[model samples]
Target: MSLTRRSLVEYAAAHFGWRRAYGDTTEIDSLLNEQALTAYTEAADHAALATAKNTDALAVQPGVLDVRGRVLADVLYLEGVLTGARNRGLDPQLIERLDAAVDHGHELTVLLADTVRTTAAVHAAS
Candidate 1:
């Protein structure tokens, strides 16, 4: 299942405890831009596992969530680092895996934050 803004935000809000208003969206961006790629890749690798059907996508359900949760944790842990990098005049290129449709600039941040909040609200409902 591809991650839609509404779905992902809602999932984050509910499963991740993020609020739609004034949500901690930086965490999610960082996860997508940095941490989650690895887990996403790993999840992809397990996609072919026949026994993984009990989970959402692939691998054992618990294992899939575990990987995703680890990525989320990494996003949380690296908050200070990402900020510091930005403070140091680091305009690091975003990972290529991020949606090309999503801008990676200040303007994009504002838009993305709103989208995240909206999704988070939906996730909360679920």
Candidate 2:
């Protein structure tokens, strides 16, 4: 499924204990949307470059790229949230929650990178 602001908000709520009442999510949502758009743009560029480098290469599945982009966008969102909370001097509990969320985001990023690399290798060989 495509990434949505609601999904990201739900993720923040569930994982970081973020509450809409605590802070207006407008800024966060805007940043996330921007990052998501950038991810798609970069993904398209990467796909184009990959295809150009290897005329025989099978087209990379757009879904795979989309998932990769979403994972990256999540990581960036978590990082931004953590930074913003730190800058605002939010409660320690919320900061800790966001810290953990960032750690989880890092883990997700690593896994996604590995998966993409492996998938790309497989695609290149086929």
Candidate 3:
């Protein structure tokens, strides 16, 4: 069976009990491995804020650097997992399921980012 993007996203959302409709054209971007979604979400607010505040001449900051590094590691790990899964001749459906889970996690990150930004705006207004 061939793996399509649709099948993967559905599996991810279902695993998380997330009911929101995910569009096919929606792009998933993140700096994490498949296993790091939970970790990133748990730390997103503090990590994101620190990243935003650490602008200086010196490139290496603290929180932001750590977050970015972890994100890159996650992406690499995910890529390896995907490649390995495909190489194993795993059922297309099963592979799609894992892919969907990862995609869902990435989408959640985006949603979280949106929420954080909106909350910050509200705080600023008040």
Candidate 4:
């Protein structure tokens, strides 16, 4: 299945302590927007670099990368938060969930990156 912004948000909310309340919405929205913007910018930068190299590299889809980027960002943010929580002696169950989330996020990121790399390689070969 294709990665989606909503899914990424849901995953973070489920694993991390992200809330969908009034105050938290702003932060969540900002993170999503930032990742989306970064994804597009990176895609453009990649395209420019490919052009400079004179190789017909396939264009990376910003939407796909945006979700992956958000997932990675969320995982990193959660890891720090988890560390703080651990230091504060928070609930063991919550810590376990956060740890699982981080591991899952890393797996997803690697899989996505590999898929993108394989696709680009195929396109370049063609």
Candidate 5:
């Protein structure tokens, strides 16, 4: 249901439990409830950019994931699907969601890193 750049989310899930929520459901929730709307938006945009000459556009790296939790290569399922994606057709909406997940995953990673740095600095100063 989500693409995570780091295992931090898995750690959080284990710590909080899969179904537990620490904040408002709208802002935060169990991974099951996490909306990750930005992921959807980005994947759609990426799909639109996929071309016969540019299968890379549909690629989901280790960093991004489809709703089903499959990586980009798995999304295509068959090798021929990837080879002929431009001619066989790939779903733009699926690509959009994957791209969005990657974008948001990166954003969350940066935010988490900054928070950790700031907290460490404050603790050291104290």
Candidate 6:
């Protein structure tokens, strides 16, 4: 399902324990940005998967900036945000999927971290 700001923020506040609210929303805004970026990147990855293409579009083109690292950073940040998002809410129907989403986020973070670290190591060793 598509994520809306209300859904995202409410979900975070309800499930993620975003209890702290000051006059300035810098922290929440950062979280929201991370969530939106993650959602957008995840959707693009899904689309690429459906089309039988490389999920990381950056991996497809040479000299295209290869934003895999940046994307992976966002994914890693997103996992934390999502973990918080699922911290509170409960639903027999929705809980399973939400759990899976959080799990997926975690797995993505690990995978990306490993890949980036390995790549960096290789580059460093060279």
Error of 6 at 41 (Å): 13
The parts of candidate 4 lying over 4 Å away from their true place are 1-60
- Which residue ranges in model 5 land beyond 4 Å of their true spot? 1-89
RMSD of 3: 14.7
TM-score leader: 4
Clashing pairs in 5: 39-100, 39-101, 43-95, 43-96, 43-97, 43-100, 44-96
Error of 3 at 107 (Å): 0.7
How far in Å is the alpha carbon of 105 misplaced in model 6?
A: 0.5
Whose lDDT is higher: candidate 4's or candidate 5's?
Answer: 4
Tens digits of per-residue lDDT, candidate 4, 1-126, equal 234775687689978877654357767687689789989988988776756764443555444467688888988998898899899999999899988988988999888777667657778789
User: In terms of lDDT, which candidate is stronger, 1 or 4?
Assistant: 4
TM-scores of the candidates in the order shown: 0.29, 0.49, 0.38, 0.52, 0.32, 0.34
Which is the better candidate, 2 or 5, if ranked by TM-score?
Answer: 2
- Candidate 1 structure quality by residue, lDDT tens digits, 1-126: 235776687777888777564347876685566557777878776657744453322223344345445555555445545656657756556322222322233344455445545554655676
Better of 3 and 4 by lDDT: 4
Q: Count clashes in each candidate, considering only residues at least 3 apart in sequence or on different chains.
A: 4, 0, 5, 0, 7, 1
**40-90 in candidate 2: lDDT tens per residue?**
988888777876764532344454567778978988988998999999999
Better of 4 and 5 by TM-score: 4
Top candidate (lDDT): 4
Alpha-carbon lDDT of model 2: 0.75
lDDT of 3 by residue, 1-126 (tens): 123564576678889987444344323332224338767777778677657764542333343345545655675667677778989998999689778766765665565555545555655676
lDDT of 5 by residue, 1-126 (tens): 245643567677788867334466543554434446656767787666654334442232222322224332343444334345445556876455565565565565555455545555655676
* Weakest lDDT window of 10 consecutive positions for candidate 6: 57-66
Q: In model 5, what lDDT does residue 6 have?
A: 30
Show the lowest summed lDDT stretch of 10 residues, model 5.
57-66
